[model samples]
Target: MNKKAIWAIIGLMSAAVIGVVVLQMDLIRTAVKVNEERFEKNVFAALNTVVRRLEAEENREVFQHSINGFVTAYYEEHDNTGEGKPEFTLDYSGEDGRPMLSPKLSHSSLLDELMAEFANPCTCSQCMARKDNTYRSLMVYFQQNTREFPLEQRIKLQHINGVLKQELGNRGIDTDFNYGVFSREKKSFIIVDGHYVVEDAQPKEILPGYRNIYNSRYKVDLFPEDMPSPGLLMIHFPARTSFVWRSLWLNFLGSIFFTTIILFSFAYTIHVIFRQKKLSEMKTDFIN
Candidate 1:
């Protein structure tokens, strides 16, 4: 083959190799992007689940406290010892004169009635006004009695940590994470990583070691129903980027290995072709 044809073949092969490498790199980039997106989605979902569970737990505690208080008050008002049957009762007579049945007005019955009323409040003007007042009073009582507890007392660090770990693990994310509970009322992080932070530092200053905690966009309100300023539950994974890339490392290495092999093979083939052409020229000259 002439030098021009040999050079042309070399250029074509080089271009083909370059194109293959570009396509491979693009494929690796696309895979990395998809992995990162999936990781982010799972993290967000886990955070949401943790927030909901925390809210539910707090609500349950508050309602349980209120129910206990209501029961205590009912017994005290009825002048009955809690050990015996309730003294409050009402008599009813049948028109056929069979026998009169006595209905007991226990605290349980009263609670049932309240629940029924709450589920279906009367819409009449007078009834609505009364119901509104009752609702306000009940809410006030709950706030004063249950919701007024300090943030640390309201939620335990172990519980928060455990819930986060469980939820994240459930979604196949087992990375090391840092978390902080930012109190909107206090305008600072009240708790971080199973410890109460009493330094009163701003959330941005709380986790100096893990700067990503404050910068993280993965946060949810601690209790959305809490009026005005529900606290924030923030989470950050230090190894998130590495974790996302972990699954693609094999593919990346494989691409590099194969591309290197192809380039090596092309260079060897070109060298052989040139050497064979030179040997043929020498043979022809010797024969002539």
Candidate 2:
């Protein structure tokens, strides 16, 4: 083997290595991309589930408050004696043949009608979902106090974050997550944080409320513009970017070992060929 042939082999091997490296890099990128897309899809679905549940819960709370108010009002008018619980009878002789509590005020009738309207009936797929008003209206009759409760309730930041953590678990997303609520009205500040966080999710300039947790590209809007304190819900996934590398670490190591062996054996073969050619040339010169 001459020097020229040796140099040519080295060039060919280098080109082959570079080509394989380029291809491998692209393949890794593609795999990561596909994984990310699937992750986002799952996150979106999970978010939809949570939003639906929130809506249903809000309706239920409203209905309960309404019935409580109605019952308290009715008792104030009817209760002449300071009795613990009042006993009342309803007549079922109305046009609808339904039980009626004193047709004079017809307040009970209105309550019954409201209960009937909100009652869950359908067994279909859509009805079974949280979007459907599948819960029967809860009725409580005869309460002492008639005071109205506050219109707005503070959102539980911790509970919501915990639910999101559970949501990811149920969907088999193993990566860490963090949530932050941002408000533009209060001088563009973060008022609250969902406590599900990891160390990597923190931004360099620490905000007022949020802690560094998981970092992800998924951001959801919580309560939107309907609430008195409207804000944006940010969900982060810190480990998502390195998932492919972690999962395929063994395969990458094996590839490196295999490549090293192949290159070393090739180099040894070239060395042996050069030595034999040198010995043959010296023998020919001595015989001549």
Candidate 2 residue lDDT tens string, 40-100: 8888777666655544455455555664565676677556555433333444455634444
**Cα-based lDDT at residue 282, candidate 1:** 99
True-structure RMSD, every candidate = 8.0, 8.4
Best model per lDDT: 1
Give the lDDT of residue 2 in candidate 2. Answer: 71
In model 2, the worst 10-residue window by lDDT is 137-146
Best prediction by TM-score: 1
For model 1, what is the error of residue 274's alpha carbon versus the real structure, in angstroms, after optimal superposition? Answer: 2.2
Per-residue lDDT tens digits for candidate 1, residues 1-288, read: 888999999999999999999999999999999998898899889888888787668765675667667557766765565454453322224343221113356544544554565577568875565455545655565566656676667787888889999999999998888888877767777788988877544444544654577779888877665575458888988888889989899999999999999999999999999999999899999999
